[model samples]
Target: MASLFQRRRNKATQVERVRERRHEGFLRYAGFRWAKISASLCLLVIVSYALVDVTPRHNGGSWYGYTLGTIGAGLILWLTALGYRKRKMTSDHWSLKAWTSAHVYLGLSLIVIGTWHTGFQLGWNVHTLAWALMMLVILSGLYGVVVYATLPAALSNNRDEMTQMQMLEAIRAFDRQLHTAAQPLTPEDTAPVLAALDEDPFAGGIGARLSGRYPDCATAAAHRALSASRSSDAEAREKVVGLLSQKQAALGRLRQHLRIRALLEIWLYVHVPLTFALIAALSAHIVSVFFYW
Candidate 1:
């Protein structure tokens, strides 16, 4: 009886393992198919552009520009459809890794098609504005790509699966430990510890955060003060200094975490506004082209 039960349990586990494998295979196939279809369509548009001759129209317009723009717009529409389809399908289909790969490669292709559509012309008009906005969107997207590709790995290695708040909490715990360790020090030696605790962590403005030059970082100031303080017991003073060094190290880690987060967020500011502007400019450009012709 015991042997029969064990065999049944193993069989059930094997079935579950097979199911999981099948699910993963399905996901891989879906992702590959999506990428393949989008890529093939893009290639087809490129080939059509090459085969179909578009002569330049007079009066500040060209058949080439209109043709390229129409094809580019179609690709953009298809890409947008894929995004919507992925969202509707399931979360796994829109994984960050897959979305990022699509975003970067497809976005680069947009730059090529959009520039060609402009025919390298720039002026004080809606067309120029549309072109500029598209460039800004592409540049901001590139920034996001770089940050996502590099910083997430760095953040993972630095944090080891811990959340940002958890990392900050750990740093604070270390600070508390240091505070306890410094408890035995004399008043003269304890001044820096007090100063560090009193310091404002969020006093810097946006510029200071971006530039990484905190003018009012009390931790550094306290360390300097501690180093210069004349103490009667050299041994105790050295111990306090050691604790201050550890505090500085902890503070540095906290600042690094903040910097990485800031880098991740900064590009969105450029991207979102440029996207809105692109929409408005594109609308005007389209209307002008059709209405005037």
Candidate 2:
């Protein structure tokens, strides 16, 4: 019975190790403690909004509005400080994970706070513009949460245990094979092969990265050309065609990997820039409200 118990413990440890290896990530960190906090904060703000009865149509100038506004503004500053918090590494309780967990939850809470600050009254003013930008930033952060949770799995599956450098190296090896194999082909057939070899793998920029659709893939063109040309000479065409197929398949995996990675990371480009923009718009909103006051 003791031996059986030990074996079960060992098996459980092995399973846990395997799970850790795949690595889902931080969005669901600590059993979604942050998500719960965010939900509760939102609920509290919303409940308070419904319960508190204010005059002058319940706008931003109210006392409760000022309280919510104070909290929201402080939240915006604190959430933005995550950029700075991330730069310094720490090992104790105030680790990056703790900071990020707080960032996500508290950032989410701001949605309620900011909305309540307006007393659910929106207008065509700098205040509304700031709120819009803040919403955009938060939406982008939520996108980050989604991609972070899901894309890592897809990325791992696509990689098949290969590293980024290894993927690039595999492409290089395929190119070399394609080049050597294509040398004997006729000039017309060789045009597409040369184009395939000559084209930069990283050429397509943001559109290609995002879409993962390389319509003008020289390797694909060469494969199509060679597939047709296979009728001319069975053996030689087969070799070149096979190599092109290999190259195309490898490129597809690479592109898929890149696309997943880009999806995982691309939200930051939207989130960070808009964070600054939100802060600036928020500053303008505050200044306009006070300057007019």
Candidate 1, superposed: residue stretches over 4 Å from native? 1-60, 76-100, 160-162, 174-192
Candidate 2 residue-wise lDDT, 169-228, digit = tens:
988998888788877778878888899998788778889999999988888888898888
Could you tell me which 10 consecutive residues in candidate 1 have the lowest summed lDDT? Answer: 21-30
Candidates' TM-scores? 0.72, 0.87
RMSD of each: 5.9, 3.7
> Weakest 10 consecutive residues, lDDT, candidate 2?
21-30
Candidate 1 local lDDT, 83-173, one digit each (tens)? 3555553446465445545655666677767776775676899888887888888888788867876886676666667776776676576
Q: How many times do residue backbones clash in model 2?
A: 0
Q: Compute the lDDT for candidate 2.
A: 0.84
Best by lDDT: 2
